[model samples]
Target: MEELTLTTPALLFSAISLIMLAYTNRFLAYAAVIRNLSEKYRERPQDSLIRQIDNLKLRLNLTRWMQIFGISSLLLCVLTMFLIYINQHVVAVWIFGTALILLILSLAFLIREIQISAQALQHHLSDMEESLKK
Candidate 1:
């Protein structure tokens, strides 16, 4: 492969930064929902509320893993740049490849979390439609 340039890893910096920001926003929103659910459950426990809380817990875990992989990717990119600076082309290539894979894994988890979240929303919509029918 050609020499690993600083620009190559630098390009990933922008993408990783934006991804981390999105993950953070998702985490914060989940936290808010969890807190709201907790209060509502405390006031009056319901099976549906319990299920929603369980679903949120799974989503929260997925988001956590997504953040972890994303951050790992960013760190690997920085490490790869350093390796390139030190003229370790072989190792730099491996590290850069690993970073790319981690980024893909992070996005995969993000997709899964979104799919689950959509299901939860659909449940709410279905309830509303049922009420309308009533």
Candidate 2:
């Protein structure tokens, strides 16, 4: 295996920063939706609204996990760079590998969240189609 250098882990800095920004944006969007749904539910509670809120709750949890893992990955990447800087090349390589794994897990959660979001949209579309047919 090639020697682990500070530059190697440093490479993830930009990519991780971009991913974290995107995740934060997603989280903010979800918060807005939840707030809007809460107001509607308060005005007049309905089964559909309750269902939507439930779905949002699950999605929110998933988003939280995604952020957690992504941030952890970024943190690990930084730690890896520090290790390399201090001449701990072997440990740095291990830390970098773990960081990569965490990133992959974060992306998996994102994929699951997107799937749930698409399914929710599909449900709304189906309801609209049924109403139109009536």
Candidate 3:
């Protein structure tokens, strides 16, 4: 039992919980930004706001996925820790590692989505500046 202390799953669970909380907070802020923009610059006709709306909708959906994945990871970490405490080494490590990897992959997808949004906004702003100069 003493040897199993080194493999305590509580550490993983704690870290996972913190990471999930941070990610959730970030997504909430992002949603707030989108809501504000949608309310302020919402035009019926086609405009930059349309693209923003599309991006916001997609992001919100992705955020929901993040929540699901975060909770799954959290649960897996807690379960893995308990299993490890009972000396179930193989399955615990395998599952906890898998959950961590999945969580990382989910975050990667979000980063890419945000990058696309930034690029779109930059292109639109540049085009607008060009038109103004004309």
Q: For every model shown, what is its TM-score relative to the native structure?
A: 0.97, 0.97, 0.73
Candidate 3: tens digits of C-alpha lDDT, residues 1-134: 23434345566666767867876886888778887876777545457677777777787777677677777877877777777778888878787777787677667766876786677679789989999999
lDDT, candidate 2, 3-81, per-residue tens: 8888887888898899889889989999999999999999999999998999999999999999999999999999998
* Model 1 spans with C-alpha error above 4 angstroms: none
- What value does the lDDT take at residue 123 in candidate 3? 79
Point out the worst 10-residue segment of candidate 3 by lDDT. Answer: 1-10
Flag clash pairs in model 3: none
Give the per-residue lDDT of model 1 (tens digit) for 14-91: 999999999999999999999999999999999999999999999999999999999999999999999999999899
lDDT of each: 0.95, 0.93, 0.73
Model 3 segments more than 4 A misplaced: 1-8, 41-44
Superposing all C-alpha atoms, what RMSD in Å does each candidate have to the true structure? 0.8, 0.8, 3.4
